[model samples]
Each structure stands twice: as structure tokens, then as C-alpha cells.
Target: MLYLKSIGTPLVLVMALFALGGCEQAEKSAQQMLNQAAESAKQAIDKTNEAAQQALSEATGSEKTDKEDSKDADGQKI
Candidate 1:
């Protein structure tokens, strides 16, 4: 139908944009680009681990209720 075509066309355009987002070339200087990507990924993982450790350190308290309270206050899920 005409309505289906209208909705599908916009969705297709949006999907196309998303699909092209990660298609940037890895740079003419391949070694530099690879090293940059590796460093960025490493820093991201390190920050994630640091956040987890700080959350645990904050939440592991004297009693079950206190631990639960700290977790709730910090908005830490699980």
C-alpha cells in the first residue's frame, strides 16, 4: 500500500545511514590507525574495570541491607 511504502522508505534511509557510520577507512597510515584503535579499546576496558571495582568497593558493606542500600544509591545494577 502507499502507507507502507512511505513508512518503509524512511526506515530504509535510516538504516542506510547507520550502515555507513562504521565504514570510515582505517587511514592511509595503517600502523598509526591500528595503534590508536588498540589504545582506545584498552582505555575503554580499563575504565569499565575501574568502575566495576569502585562499585564493588562501595557496595560490599557490613550487612546485607547496607550493601543493598549502597548499590541502590550508586544506581549500580546487579
Candidate 2:
């Protein structure tokens, strides 16, 4: 009984240490994954904004051309 008691405490401590180490590694991995997801979301938002601006510019340009076509050389409306 004395021998078992002496060894059991050390064994329990080693197992606890291993468990804590594993938990720390898992936390780091989860954080890395979250960072990657956020970056991807930012890139998508940037692309969407660029496309919206391009569409707006094209629409504005077409409106100007249409107005010019409706006017005569003297700047009067046909």
C-alpha cells in the first residue's frame, strides 16, 4: 500500500499536465482558424465594394451619353 501511494500521486500530476497542454494547443488552433475566416470575409467585402463602384460609374457614364444624343449641336433639345 505504501508503494502504490507513492507512485499514484506522481502519475496523477503527470496526466493533469498533459491535459492542460492539449487544451492550450486546441485554443491556439481555434484562434488561427477564426483569424483566417475574418480575413476571407474582409476580402469578399472589398470585392463587392469595387464591383458596386464600377457599376455606378458605368450607369452615370451612359446617362451622360444619352443626354448628349438627345441635344442638337446648338445645345438645344431635339
Candidate 3:
């Protein structure tokens, strides 16, 4: 139709410009989100390792007392 012919070209150009800007902004936002997620994941892993290490150290320390256990007449240890 003649109506489409007159407006189609300009609409296409405007749409193209808006799409390009939108894509650029989307890419920047995605990059920022990825960076934040990675940093948070790394911090969480570090904290978990620290906690595990602490728990293991504590468990090991309690399991084997620094002093040797004394034996009784029945060969039992207190």
C-alpha cells in the first residue's frame, strides 16, 4: 500500500538505531551481572573452605588428646 511505502523506510531506520543501542546496554548489564555472580561464588567457596578447615582442625584436635591416656589393670584407658 502507499501508506506503508511512505512510512516503512523511516520506521525501519529508527528501529535499527534503537535496537543497536538496546543491544549495547544489554551486553554491558550482562557483563556486570556475570562479574558480580563470579565474585560472590568465589567468596562463598572461600568461606566454606575456611569453615571446613576449622571444623576439621577442631575435630582432629579433640580426637587425639595431647597427653597419652593412662591404662588401668584391665588394660582400659580413661
State the local distance difference test value for candidate 1.
Answer: 0.58
Q: Tens-digit lDDT track for model 1 on 1-78?
A: 334234354445445555666343323334344455567668889999999998887676446676576675467955
Candidate 3 per-residue lDDT, tens place, 1-78, comes to 334234354455445555777677656665565566567668889999999999999988876653334655675776
Better lDDT candidate (2, 3): 2
Q: Ranking under lDDT, best-scoring first?
A: 2, 3, 1
Q: Stretches of candidate 1 above 4 Å error?
A: 1-28, 62-78
Indicate whether candidate 1 or candidate 2 has the larger TM-score.
2
Ranking by TM-score: 2, 3, 1
Candidate number with greatest TM-score? 2
lDDT of 2: 0.71
Q: Local error of candidate 1 at 18, Å?
A: 25
What is model 1's C-alpha RMSD? 14.3
Pairs with steric clashes in candidate 1:
none
TM per prediction: 0.44, 0.68, 0.55
Superposed by TM-score, candidate 3 places the C-alpha of residue 5 at a distance from the truth, in angstroms, of 49
Error of 3 at 10 (Å): 35
Give the runs in model 3 whose Cα sits over 4 Å from its true position: 1-22, 66-78
Each candidate: how many clashes?
0, 0, 0
lDDT string, candidate 2, 1-78, tens digits: 334234354445445555677677656655565566567668889999999999999999999999999999999999
